[model samples]
Target: MTERVCVGAIAGAFGVRGEVRLKSFTSQPNDIAAYAPLYTEDGSRSFTVRLTRPVTGGLGARLSGVETREQAEALKGVTLWADRDKLPALPDDEFYHADLIGLSVHDTGGALLGKVRAIYDHGAGDILEIHGPGRRRVLLLPFTRAFVPTVDLAAGRIVADPPDEQE
Candidate 1:
């Protein structure tokens, strides 16, 4: 398991006073500030985000060590991470995307399909990208309750029920 999970990203400078455009990934968006002193993925830098106000694309915020628009702009695209333990405990069916990235994928008959390539949410819902076995190309499987029925994190695998294959 990764020690840190990305909680938000710095979009750009929000105001002239070191504020930034923050895109939060937390389930309770406003709670991002509770995970203070977020770290960069590379561990080279860190920031404490304080919510300034809500903005158009995302939220507006102030980042520690960012004193100017240029300094804030420099942080654009910088992802903020928090220690796994700092996050709230999830209920039975909920999962963190960081935990699902490398889990093995299998069919109901126990056939090995491949590993999880990535998970994406393009408005509608979450989609699981699976890397095909061997030379097989990548495939997108909707990560819905009907299609993906089981995710046993301890077992390091997910049981997929492809909707189209049901017929």
Candidate 2:
């Protein structure tokens, strides 16, 4: 697991002011600001988030040193990461997307399926994208208790009950 987890992203400038259109990945969207002093992916720079208001697609927020529209615009597409310690702990059933990625997947019969490449949330629920070995095509499995039976993070593996092979 990483020391820092991605919490939000800067969509772009909200208006002519220094406020940025921020997209929060946190469970509670507004909690993104509570985990202040977020850092960039490479940990090169950091910003203290102050959410101004809710905008069309996301939230309007201002960064510590961002005082101009140009500065906010320049931060577009930048993912904001917060220290893992600052985030709340999850229940045993819940797992972080970052922790699931790259984990080897297997069936109840111990047949290797693939590795988790990514996780997607299309509003309804989470989906795991598995790829490699016998999986010639990307396998998108719903990350539900029915499909995913066990996730042993310490073992770096996932036990899945995938649907029958597609022709």
On TM-score, the candidate that comes out on top is 2
lDDT of 2 at 22: 98
User: What do the candidate models score in CA lDDT, each in turn?
Assistant: 0.88, 0.93
- Model 1 lDDT per residue over 1-167, tens place: 78889999988998798899999999888889998789988989988878989999999998888999999888899999998888998998989999999999988888887889899988898999888567355768999888899999999999997654321
lDDT of 2: 0.93
lDDT of 2 by residue, 18-137 (tens): 999999999989999999899999999999988999999899998999999999999999999999999999999998788999999999999999999999999999999999785678
TM-score of 2: 0.97
Each candidate: RMSD: 2.1, 0.8
